[model samples]
Target: MKELNSIPIENIYYMLCYSWDKLDYISRNKIGIEESMDIQNLLCRILVDEVDILIKKGIKKNYKELNESSSVVKGKINFKESIKYKSTKQCKVNHSYDELNENIIINIVIKTTLINLIKIEDLSISNRNKVKRLIKYFNFIDTILLNKKIFKNISFNKMNREYKFIINICELIFDNLLINKNDNSAEFYNFIEDERKMAYLFESFIRNFYKKELKGAKVYREDIYWELTGEFVEFLPKMQTDISLEYNDKKYLIDAKYYKKSLVENYGSKKLISGNLYQIFSYLKNNESKSKKDEFSTGILLYPRVDKTLDLEYSMDKHNINIYTVNLNSKWNEISKRLISLIK
Candidate 1:
C-alpha cells in the first residue's frame, strides 16, 4: 500500500474562513496554526484555546429546558409532563426552570469527538501533549451530553455569533469522524483525499481575499446568464464565476483552477488544459453583451503555481484573456501583492 498525504491544517483554516464567511477569524486569531504541527493536534489546540477563553469569561448562558420544584418559576411550568410519574405522591409543585443555556452543547459535542479521536490509533500516533490537554479540557467541561450525535444542521444567529468559529470547527471534525472498522493508519489520510474539495477551497480563498483587500475595485462572484432564450436555456446549467473584478469601466472575470499537475500533455507538447480554455472562452462569449466597454473587458483563467511557470495572454476584438498562476506557498506579503496588482 502507498502512503497518502494529508491536507495541511492551515488549509482547513482557509476553508473555514471562506465557507463560513468569517473573514475576521483567520485575520484576528492567526496563532496556533503552524505547518509543522499535525492537523489532529492543531484541531485539539483550537478547541482547547477557544473553549478556555470562553470558560474564563464564563460559559455563554441561555434559557434551557429545566423542570424541577423551585420557589419562583421564570418560564412556563409543564405541570402535566412533570407530574406524570412521581415515585412518591408528595406535595411538590413542578415548575419548568430556565437555568443555564444550551451553548455548552457545542463544548459537549467537541469534547466527545476529541475523546473518540484519542482512542483511534491512526490519529493518536503523535503529539501526546495535545492528547493530554484535550483530555483536561474535556474533563473541565461540566455539561456532559453522552449522546455522540453531531449537529449537522445548526442555524446560527446573533445570539451565537461569537461561537461561529467553534461551531464550524466542530462541523469539520464531525465530517472526519468516519467509523473505523480496523486499525488502519491510512483512514485519516483517505478521509482528506478529495481534491475537488481542495479545489473549491482554493477558489473561495482567492474570492474572499479580493472581497476583503481590494481597495477601489469591486470584487464579487458573477453569474453569467445563457445567451439563448427558450426551453433550452432553462435546461442549461448555471455559469457561475469564481471571482470577478470591476473598476474604472473595466471588468475582469477570473476562474480559479486547482491541481497537483499544472501542465497537461497535448499532442506531445506540454500546455494548459484545453477544456479550461474552452470553458473560459464560452463564459466570455455569453457575457460580452453586458460589458459597457467591451474593449476593456477581460477574462482570466487562474491556476495555483506548480512546477512550471505558464503565463499567456491573448486579445480579440473587444475582449482580452490571460492564463495566470499564483503561488500560494509564498509569503503572505508576496501573495497579497501579486493578487492586488491584478487591478492595476
Candidate 2:
C-alpha cells in the first residue's frame, strides 16, 4: 500500500534507456513529476506531459491498409475482398482504404489508465489536468480502440518501431495495474523490484553513457577472445566486459557492477567483490596482454556508490586495476563527469 509517488521515474528511465536502442532521443526528453504521485497519474504525466517530444522522436504515422465500405474509390482496392456483398447485396462497394496508420490501440492502452485514474473518487484535484491532457492526446489519434481484446491483439513491430519506448512504458503501467487489480485504493506499482532488470539497466546505461560522452575513445560491450584456438574453446565460458574503451594505445576494460552492497567482507576485512575483479582481470589478460610485457591495459571495476566508497588501485602483472564508485544518486551532470573522468 505504498504511495505511487514513491516510484522513482529514474528507475523507469533507466529501464527504458537500457532496452531502447535510441538513447539520443530519450536523453534529450525530460519530464517533471511530484514525488508523491501514484503510478497511474505518473503514467498519465508521461504520456500527456512528454507527448510533444515522444511524437517528434517517435510515433510516426505509416500508410496502412484500411478495409472499408466506401462511397468513393480509394487506394488500391481488392476485387474479391469485400465481405459486405457476400452477406447482403448493398450498393456500397467494399474496398481497401489506405490511410495514415492510426496508433489508436496504443493510444487507448495509454488513455484507459488515465480514465481509470480519473474515475477514482478520492483522486486529487492536482492530477485532474494530467488525466485531461492524456485524454486529449488520445483524441489526437484517428481512432481510439477501447476494447481490451484489441489492445491485446495489437503488437509493436519494425513498422512502428518509433513508439517502442512509449509503448514499453504503457505496457509496464497496464501490467502493474493488472497484477494489483484487487487493490481498490490504487496503491503502489512494483515496477522496480526486478533486480536482474536493474543490473542490465545499470550496465547498459554505463556502456551508452561512455559511448555518448567519451568522444576520444571507442567503447564496446563485447566478448574478449581468450588465446584459445580449438573448437573446444567455444565451450569455455564467454568473457564479456561491460565496457572496453580504447583510445590509441591506452586500453581500459571496465565492468559495471550493480549490487545492494558494493563491498563484501573478505577475510574479516571489507574489499571489492573478488569475482568482479577476477572477471575484469581475465578480460585484460586474455585480450590486452598479447604476449608482450610492454603492452598493458587498465582494468576497472566501477560500481554505483551505495553506503560505502571503494576507490582502490593496484599495479600487478604490468596492468593497472582500479576499483571505483560513481555516485548515481547525484545530479546526472555530475554522474556523467565522473564516468568521463575514469579514463582521464
Candidate 3:
C-alpha cells in the first residue's frame, strides 16, 4: 500500500468507508471530512460529526437490568436482599428491573473513543474541542475499559445499525492509537509502517468496493478446493480468495496485495512477486478443476500502486493471469475508474 500519509486524506476516508460498506451513508453526511486534514484529525472529525447526528437523532437505548431499592415492586423483587438491607422495614423493595437506557456498549465505545482521541497530541485544537463538545452529549452513557475484545460483544440490529459506522471508527482508533502510560500522552500509530493492518484494510476495501460497484456481478470471497484428494487432506491449508466476481458466466478471482514494494528487484531486473503469482495461479487452476467450466477462469494479482504502475499479463495452462496496480494516490474518480478497468 502507498504510505498512509502520502495518500490524500479524503482517499483514506473513502477507503475506510468502503471497507466498512458505509460509503453511501458517509457520502450523504460529508460535512467534516476534508482532504487537507491528517488521518487522526480526519477520523476524529468523522466521529464527532456522526456522534453529533446520533445524539440529535436520539441515542439508541436498550433494556438493561438494574438492581435498585425502590418502594414500588417493578420487576422481580429480591426478598432476601430487601430483608438483609432492612429495606423491608423501610417499605422499600430491592428489585431488579429492565430499564431502557442509553448506557449500552455501542454508546460506551463512542464515548471512550472520543475521550481517547482528546489525548492524542496530533489532534487539532478545533477537532479536540469538537470531540469534547460531542462527548458532553454522551454524559448519560457510561464509559468502559476500552479494548479490542469489546467490539466483539456488540451486535447490530436495525435499530442500532447506524452505530456500526461510528463503532468501526472507534475500533480503528483503539487499534492504532498508542497511549503513553507515564505521561498520559497519546500518539496515532503510523499506519504505513504496519503492513499487516494495511494489508487487511486494503483487501477489505477492494472487496467491498467491487461488491458495491460491479453491476449485476456476484462479488464475494470464495473457497477453492484442492484438486488432489488424500486421506489427510484436512491438514492442507484452505484456499480462500480475497475477492471473487462472477459476471455473465465469467469468473474473476482477485488477490489484493498490499506491500511496500509492488515488484521484487532481482539482480538488475524487476519481477512480479513469485509467491503472489503462485498463489493466485493455484486458486484459478484448482477452482477450474473442480467446476470444469468451458470458459477459462481469470486470476488477477491486484496491488496498490507503489513507486510505479504495473499491468503485466500472462497466459498459463489456458488460464489468464493479470498483475495490475491501482494508484491510490490519484484522484478518487480516477482511482475508481482504474479499479473498474482492471477486469476489463
Candidate 4:
C-alpha cells in the first residue's frame, strides 16, 4: 500500500515479502531470495529512487531522539529510525558501511534493493552472459523471466525473432539457477521470504541429496493441484496447497515450517505461537485420504533444522503423522534424506 517513495525501507521489505508469498511456486522457488531476488531488487530500487526523489524536494528532518532516519534520506528513507539497528551485527560487517550509522536505513535499503534487481536481461546473455550458458538447458525460461522482469529490456525486446531461441535459453537458465541457491548473491537475504521459498528449499533438498543420478521423478511437484474436493476440501480456500512426491501415482505431501528450535513441540493453537505441530495434522487430515490409496499423502511440518532436539509424532486415527524436527543450526538439506530413509 505504501508507495516506494513515501515509505520506509522496512515497509518496502514488508511489501515485497507479502507479495512474494502470493507468487506461484515457479516464481517463488526459481530464485533463492528472501523476497525472491527480482522483487527484492526492484522494490529496493523503487524505494531508493523515492528516497532520492524526496531529497530533491528539499525535505529534511531527523528523528534521532525517537531513533528514526528516513527523514534524513535524500528522499524516501528514515536513516534515524534505523538507529536502533546500528548496533546490530550486520552494521559492523560491510566495509561499504560506517560506524556512525549515518544511513543505516538508507544503506541497508540500498544494498538489499540492489540485490533484488536482477532482471532476466541483467541475469541474461549481455551483462554476465549467463543467458547463453542457460540456453543449452531448460526450455521454459521465458515464462519464468516474464514473472520476474517487471521491467523492459529494449535490446532483448528488439532482438530478431530468430534470437528468441537464445532468449528462451537464457530464461530457462535463469529459472533453473533461481530454483537452485548456490549463488553468492543469494546469500544476501535470509530464507524467510515466503512459504514457497521454504517449500522450494525442501524440494531442492530432495533433489540435491535424494535424487542422486536419478533426478527426473519430480513430477509430483507439478502434479499437485488445488482441488475443491477430496480430504483437503474444507481447507481448499486457505491451506496454501501441499508438497507432494509423486512416483507413478503415489503422492506424498511435504508441508514445511520455519520454526525456532527452542519452540518446536506444541500445537499452533493460540497458546503456542512459537510451536506449530497440528498445522501439519490439519494438512494430513485434509490431504491424506483412503481413495488416494494408490497415492498416499502425509504432511511434513518441516521446521528449519536446528539442534533443538525435540522430534515428535502424532497418533491421529491410524495415520503415522511424523512431526520431525530438523536442525537448522547446522543445515536444512538433510531433512529430505532423513525423510526418505525414515520412510524407506
Candidate 5:
C-alpha cells in the first residue's frame, strides 16, 4: 500500500469521505481541500466544518430516562424510594421519566473526540483553535470515557441518520489516537503504520467506491458456502468476499488487501503472497460450484501499489484470477479511473 506520509493528504481525505459515505457533504462544503496540510490537520478541518454544519441544523435530541426526586410525578412513580426518603414530609416524590435532551450517545462521542483532538500536538495551531471553538457548541452534551465498547451500543435510525457520518469520523479519530493514563493526554499516531485499521479503511473505500461509481452492475459482499456433502461441515469457517460484482450473468469476487509490501521476498526473489492467492482461489472455486447456471466467475486480488506496479493474470479450472495494484500516490482523478477500470 502507498505509505500514508507519501500519499497526498487530499487523497486520504477523499478516501475517508468515500468510506464513510459522506462524499456529498464533502463536495458541497469543500472544506480545506486546497491547503497544504498533513493528515491530522486535514481531519481536524473536516471535523470542524461538519460539526459547524450540524450545529446550524440543530443537534439531535433523544429521550433519556432520568431518575430523581421531584415534586411533580412523571412517567413512573417509585413509591418505595419516595417512602424511604420520607417524601410526604418534604412534599416531594421520586420518579423516573424520559426527557428529550442533547446528552445522547452520538453527541457525547463527538464532544469527546473534539476534546481529544485538541490535545494532539501534531494538529496545526489553527486547527486546534477551530476545534476549541467547536467545543463550546457542545456544552449541553455530556462527556464520557470513550472506548471501543461504547460504539457498539450506538444504533442509527431515520431520526438519527444524519449523525452517522459524523459518528464515523469520530470513530476513525478514536481508532488512530492513543491515550495516556498518567496525565490524560492523547497522541495521534500515523494511521499508515497501523495495518489493521488501514486494512479496514482500504476495504471499505473500495467497496463504497465501486458501489457508487459502477453502473449496470450490482455490488455487494457475499457469503460463499462450501460445496461439500459431509455432515460435519459445520466445523468449517464461512467464506466471505470483500467485494462481489455481478454483471451480464458473470460474477467477480474481489479480495482487497492493504499491506506495506505488495510482494514478499523468498530466497532473494520477490513472489506473490501464497496465502492471499489460496484464499481467493478457494472463494472462486466454491462459489462456482454452488452456481447452477453456466455463468463465468473470476477472482481478483486487489492491493494498493507499494514499491512497484503489479498486474498479473492467471487461469485455472476455467476460472480467471487477477492480481492488480492501484497506486494511491497518483492524482485523485487517475486513481479513481484506475480503480473503475480494474473490473471493467
Candidate 6:
C-alpha cells in the first residue's frame, strides 16, 4: 500500500542495479539516456499490468474458494504481499500497453511492480500465466475478429491464423510477462478488453483489403461513373431519396453497409429487415424510371462478405428488380474472378 509517487529516493540505486545487473557494472553506468528511458518505460508497463492482473485474480480466486468450501471464514488480505507500488532508476521496453485496469495505474507504481516481477522470478507462476494468457488471448482476438463477444470461441483454426502476423512482435512480451501454465480469473476478464482493442485494430485495414487492382490505368470518368439512377427530383418522392450511381453501365442504385457475415444471417434470414427491403424497393421504383430499353433498374446493397455467398440474389418486384449480394472477404484475385462471374 505504499504510495508509488513517494518511493524512497534512495531506491533509485536499486533500480539502476537491477537494470545493469543483467550486464556488468561497467555496462550499467555506460547505458544511454534514450536506451535507459526505453527500458524504464517497458518496465513500467509490465509492472503496472502485473499488479492489475494479480490483485484482481487473487481476490476473485480467494472468494471462489471460500464459497466452494462453504466456509464463513474471512480470507486475509496481505498488503505487504502486494508490491503494487515500486520505483526504478533504469529499464527498457517497446510498445506500450494501454492500461485496462479498473484503477488508473500510477506510472511509478507500474515501474516498481516490473522490478519486483524480475526480482521474484521464483514467485508463483499461477499469476504470471494468468497475465500472459490474458494478454495473448486478448491481443489475438482483437487482431482478427475485433468484436467484444469474439472471445466466446478461441479454439477455431481460422481465428488462430491471425496470431502469425503478431507473433514476432509479441514474442518478447509473452516470454517476459506471462507465467503460461497458471490459472488466473483476473487475467481472463482482462482478455475481453484486449480482444476488443485488437479486433478494432485489425479491421482498420478494411479499405486496404479490398483495394482495386486495375488491369490498365483507370480513366478518370470511364471505368466507374456516378450516372444518375433517376432524375434527382423524381427519385425523392418514392418514400426515399435517389443519388444513386451507375457503376460500369449497370443501371442500379447502391447503398453501402459494412455488415459482417454473422449479422447477415441473423438479420436477413429471420425476416427482421422488412424495412430494409422497402428502402431498397424505393430505390428500384425511382431508378426503374431511368431503365434503358433492355436492362432492369436494380437496387444493390453492398456489404462486407460473411458466409462467402457466390453472388446470392433475392427476387423482388416479380424478379424484375433484383437485389444481389457482393462478397468482401476473398483475396483481390479471387474477388475479381468471382466478380467476372457475377456481372454476367
Extract clashing residue pairs from model 1. 62-101, 66-97
* Candidate 1 global Cα RMSD: 4.6
lDDT for residue 198 in candidate 4, whole number 0-100: 45
What tens digits encode model 2's per-residue C-alpha lDDT throughout 210-271?
77667877888767778768868769887787887787668788888867777778889887
What lDDT score is found at residue 243 in candidate 4? 49
Better of 1 and 4 by lDDT: 1
Steric collisions counted per model: 2, 2, 0, 29, 0, 14
Per-residue lDDT over 1-344 for candidate 3, one digit per residue giving the tens place of the 0 to 100 score: 33543887778888888998987766588455566677788878888878888889988888999999877889999988889667435878889989998888888888888988988987999999988888888888887778767898888988888888889889988999998989978999867568898799899999998888878888998888888877999898999999988877888889998888888889999888999988998888788755644138889999888888898989987788998988888899999999888865
Better of 2 and 5 by TM-score: 5
lDDT of 6 by residue, 128-236 (tens): 4534544432221212212223222322245233222222112222223433335421111111124343233223222212222222212121122223466564543
Model 5 spans with C-alpha error above 4 angstroms = 1-5, 34-36, 72-75, 292-295
lDDT of 4 by residue, 1-344 (tens): 01111223332332233333321322333332342234334333333333343335533222332222332333334445455557663342111222232222222222222233343233422322322332222222122223335222413334223223223323322333342245434322323444455445444543333333224434233223333447756565565433445544444455555433325244553222323455555555655443563224555555444444445655556455565654432222343345565435
TM-score of each: 0.78, 0.70, 0.93, 0.36, 0.92, 0.28
Q: Which residues of candidate 2, in runs, are more than 4 Å off?
A: 1-44, 52-60, 69-93, 104-125, 140-165, 171-193, 289-295, 331-334
- As for candidate 3, its clashing pairs are none
Kindly give the stretch of ten consecutive residues in candidate 6 with the minimal lDDT sum.
59-68
In terms of lDDT, the poorest run of 10 residues in model 3 is 286-295
Predicted structure with the largest TM-score when compared to the true one: 3
Runs with alpha carbons beyond 4 Å of true place in candidate 1: 1-35, 68-95, 102-104, 120-152, 177-187, 190-193, 291-296
Candidate 1: 10-residue stretch with minimal lDDT: 184-193
